[model samples]
Target: MNTQPSALANSAGPVSGDSAAAKSRVLQIDRSCRLPLMFLIACSLVWLVAGGFLSLISSIKLHAPGFLSQSSWLTYGRVYPAAMNALWYGFAFQGAMAVALWLMCRLGRAELMGGKGILLGAFFWNVAVKLGVLGILAGASTGHSMLEMPGYVSPLLFVSYCLMGVWALVTFHFRQERQLYVSQWYLVGALFCFPWIFTAAQLLLVFHPVRGTLQAVVSGWYGHALITLWAVPIGLAVLFYFIPKLFGRQLHSRHLAAFGFWTLAAFGGWGGMHAGAPVPRWISSVSIAGGMMMILPLIAVALNWHLTARGAKGPENNQVFRFVQFGAIAFFAASLLDIGGSFRVIGEVTDLTVFTTGVKALYLYGFFGMTIAGAIYYLAPKITGCDWPSDQLAKLHYLGSVVGILVLVLGLVAGGILQGVRINNPEIPFVEAIRSTIPFLGLSTLGGLLLLAANLAFLVNVIRLLALCCCTNCFASNRSPAGSGPAAAGANL
Candidate 1:
């Protein structure tokens, strides 16, 4: 494999004159977005913790319905939507934004411009999410999956997102590097596509309100597009950026990447509607065809990444690489599952069941969450100028997350299949089908608890690191000026 020095590697290893200069430049760029990145990550952790608690309540309520039945606010309907909103908007989007912004700055070789605007944008984004989640709990939910946030909160989110998007575009415009990397393509695409999908969904589903079966079609399209175009693209950008860097090589094939990118762009938007929806036959068929066609791009991407990582396997021991690799495998696995589930025969059994939920968990937590975790592990130290406080914590987090997600997904799939079989049979009682899923639901709850513990460990580590950084700054500031002394010293780390 042909290789070149990665942006991150410019600051690693020996510190000769040229190397020192290169490292300094990289640190300077990193420092520019430090505040914004830290803010995003911190907010994401807060949301992760909150989401974990909500999820635990939700999971428990699945089998033990009386657990919180007395509290109207904690009812299954409200808690479920609250948990989903917290996880999706609070943790997922924030973490993804942090990763995307940081990667864009690093790849562009440009210090992030409009730092204040970006920070302000992040603040408003969190505010909007908070209001949206609260509204859902207050029974003001729009009742659309992934678009559950109430009507009023939509504009706040859209405006905040536009601010951040503007910063991204401006940063890219003023980049030092003229040539765009494959990761850049993915990042830019995600940045641009989100608002369009978000706005259209808001208008069709929430504001104007689509009529009858067309509502299902729009909902299906919005859900699928959001995952494929927004979440998956962000995750893929990280994979493309880090795989070669970790392996000390360039990507296996740029041509393959381009092909993958365009194919995904062309088909992913239309592919998600076939998931056992109540739409017309033509609509479902188009979705299935699009999904089947997406397999080619997924294969292209998987092969490129696999071949890149085939040789230098030493870094696979590192937590960042390990998480990324796990996520990459999960991505391919999830893709295959989606393709199979899109078929009419399989969709008939899996649609509107726990099986679909299992696939979503695999994609969101297994693939997107894992990849973002890897990116955070890799970038946090660089941005904060402090090494992670403990490798033990990192390892614990990785084990818990990976195992928890797998168990949760498997349990859901098993439960869904059992329920689907019973439900499909005319002689079977609905209550009996529900009863058959209790054990698996319990297992899923256990998995959620494990993940909660893992995230708490991560939160502790981050807090410790931040405290250390603050102490170091305070100590340095006592001896010299406030900004220059500690800031320069931290940046050099």
Candidate 2:
């Protein structure tokens, strides 16, 4: 007895008559959500490619400034900042929205509300992000650090985010299921936290409501929290879904899961201060303590996931499971590094170096990036009503992402250590330290290329699947008699 409608209820494309009426209801809830998913994939791919080009250019400028001295737009300062904005806003954040919508639908047992509304939100969000990123490249930035995308950009961002947040909230409220699961807790908290933090940061930083180190404090707080508060929820929601679903088991301990969620929400806020500690020791200490305290919550989460999967069958043979499991492992590694890196002793040497970047990448790329990749692999076929266009392409996506991220992380860590060693050595020439990083930078560039290829492969697979879903003739052919016309076409293709 199938609880869901078999013929077309779960199907994301096409229906007729009695089914069509119900489908329209689902579609109303679905249309707005799916575009965000497609837009995210498109935007993330563009960012990945653009960021790769920028990284290569920035690397060249690092070793040799004369390489692009004539082009102000391609200069190291502009290229580096523009690349950061692209990766953060254009890729990572946008990707989070896609993941969030998917998770909300699956976990909450809800469909999208108004597709038109979602499209409008997507349009405004993309426009705002494009302008903000271009503003960074054009040096219209307000001289702010990570939040450098011009004053006007903040208001636009705020409005777009608010719309997205509301959509999530409404979707959650209308969810058909009872007793919301662990993923819903994370999704709801994430939806609420982002707006509060974003609004406060925008007001204090852009509106000039605060001054001096207070501004730095607010910025650092908001900056780091954006990852922990905004991105972490979606990532955790992915973990909640895939870790158990892949292994065919419920979570090992619901009590432990709740504890982890509440503890993380409580402790994640204070750890933002760690980034500002170089200027203010007290602030740094607070951040360091908060970061260290985060271990309890993280350990609980790690224990629950690992224990749950320990006795069950592993998903190693499946590509989606492989990507997600590896990413889950990295989450543990990243949290440990987060604590160590936030400490004053370690921060003294590694804060400005590539090691910090490596840790950050591990968190973003290794943890969050891999989780979403797995979800995309699992969800795309369901939504598109087709198998992946190419199994080889799926394998390529996994291998490329894994190998590329490892290469990139290793290079950054190695280069950073060398940088730290040289900086601590009073006798070492500053020029010598810079010279030593050239090889590592080259390796990082190659790694970026690998990751870019992986992303492109993923996009192609998605597009091909979407195309298949739209082909009603293709679906009709599949329903034909076994020995009749195009049986092999339905099977093999």
Per-residue alpha-carbon lDDT of candidate 1 for residues 5-44, written as tens digits (9 for 90 to 100): 4433321211112566666767776766677788889899
User: What does each candidate score in C-alpha RMSD?
Assistant: 3.6, 7.0
C-alpha root-mean-square deviation, candidate 2: 7.0
Point out the worst 10-residue segment of candidate 2 by lDDT. Answer: 7-16
Question: Candidate 1, overall lDDT?
Answer: 0.82
lDDT tens digits by residue: candidate 2, 307-412: 8788678755797789888789878888887788777787777777888777877887889888878877876655444688899888998899889888877788
Q: Which 10-residue window of candidate 1 scores lowest in summed lDDT? A: 8-17
Candidate 1 has a TM-score of: 0.93
